[model samples]
Target: MKHLPTSVKCVALLAAALLPLAASQAHAATIHTQGSIQYVCSGVGQGSLQKMQAQAAKFNLGFWMVKGPQGEYLANVPVKVMQNGKTVAKFTAGGPLCYLKAPAGTYTIEGRHDGQLRTIQAQSGTTAHYLRW
Candidate 1:
């Protein structure tokens, strides 16, 4: 009898473990609005992740909160989406993944965790930032 190689088996196991996260690309999160901007912060579970992933394409920008080398997920993060010199949107994230629907323009996305602040630049329709700290 032939058996699968150790490396092949490991890869299969890793893929299986990540199936939930990888498979979910949209979800059913409530879309919240801030003035003219609309957003959703959801991805805590498989269902939510699936819904959020689906909803993400409608938005211009997205964020994923991550930490450490292993890439652990963070939740309820403080987020601020700034355009020009003013804040267009700000909220405590509902989950690890969040999407923002803003006008087509350059914006700064900031996330605060444990007193450490991280920022990234995003172009309305073409950026997904992973806030790692």
Candidate 2:
């Protein structure tokens, strides 16, 4: 029988003992390929607001909008998720806000704000921004 030296035997035992620790340590996880989209519409008068909102909806994304003092506004629109050219989810964008978290896909999103339409394509967990002129 071939015999290992005392030091080699000890090292082998230590390596075996540490194997589980190494695997457990490797269990720490990270998020990769996760993405988001944000919208910032800043301009004077209603033109910018209208254009920005119109563009946001044109893409069919989900977002939140809050009317601010002196005609200022804040909104967050997420890209719409769709399958076979149909809208799976809809977002209500305006004061008294709401939010939706959808799985990744393409979609058509439309909303009515002040007699205008906002429609666009939305994807999974994507953030889309718009600015008014």
Candidate 3:
């Protein structure tokens, strides 16, 4: 009977352990927006969703703008989410938006502008809705 070399055995074990990691990497899907927000304000309106889309790109995140109720708009809203003065996520003005899918983690989401401030906890693959003023 022939015994496999120590190096060959180690290589085989490492490959087996890494198989799942390789597969997960390949299966990962990146969320992306097709275009910036560009909805006209027939009523309450936020900034261009297009702009949010563009901004989200910086974080490799997905973006969407929501419609305000009746006569409200999501304008000049700024969101700063920090783990400790280190901004984890910052949302620029112009969004009455929602996140359809997010990565698996705990996140603090805040929206503020025009004297109204709203904050919530974000979870993975959860939907976060933002209503405009």
Candidate 4:
């Protein structure tokens, strides 16, 4: 086989190293439309919610929402998870409840329902929030 020039070889190696990163980025979570907002939701049905609950226990962070008083599952509510004042994830409730995989730290979770805002604090072992309209 013929040897390539040093510069060409470096460029090829760089591209090879970055290919996986690019592919991963392409597959990263994406914004999805559920109801009134765009969000990256993870779980879908009852089975997914169960799986999320298990994962939440292991990952130390999870999020979900429900309607107030009657405690119905709230779907399609716009939710934003912020850590240290910077938004880490945005999701619209795909179901009456949704679970989020976030880092183990304090997060300010804001949910919008019927033009009203409901904010709450999330931390390890805290996953559920009640949102009112």
Best by TM-score: 1
Q: Considering every candidate listed, which one attains the maximal lDDT?
A: 1
The CA root-mean-square deviation of candidate 3, after full C-alpha superposition on the true structure, stands at 14.7
lDDT of 1 at 65: 92
Quality of model 2 by C-alpha lDDT: 0.43
What is the TM-score of each predicted model, taking all chains together? Answer: 0.75, 0.33, 0.39, 0.56
List, residue by residue over 1-133, the lDDT tens digit for candidate 3: 1399988888988999999988755433333332331121111233234443443433422223333566344544566544334455564644344443334465565666666766655554444344334
* lDDT preference between candidates 2 and 3, better one: 3
lDDT of 2 at 125: 58
Off by over 4 Å in 1: 1-27
Using TM-score as the measure, what is the rank order of every candidate, best first?
1, 4, 3, 2
Which of the predicted structures, 1 or 4, would earn the higher lDDT when compared with the native?
A: 1
For 1-133, candidate 1 gives per-residue lDDT tens digits of 1398988888988989988875543335778999888988875675677667766678888878988899888988999989997999899997888888888899888999999999988887774688899
Query: Can you write out model 4's per-residue Cα lDDT over 1-133, one digit (the tens) per residue?
Result: 1499888988999999999988755533343443332334444463555544444543444455666676666677877877789877776666654445555578787999888898888775565554454
Name the better of 2 and 4 by TM-score.
4
- Superposed by TM-score, candidate 3 places the C-alpha of residue 71 at a distance from the truth, in angstroms, of 7.7
Candidate with more favorable, higher TM-score: 1 or 4: 1
Task: Give Cα-based local distance difference scores for all models.
Answer: 0.83, 0.43, 0.46, 0.61
Kindly report which residue stretches of model 4 are placed more than 4 angstroms away from their true locations once superposed.
1-48
Local error of candidate 3 at 122, Å? 1.3
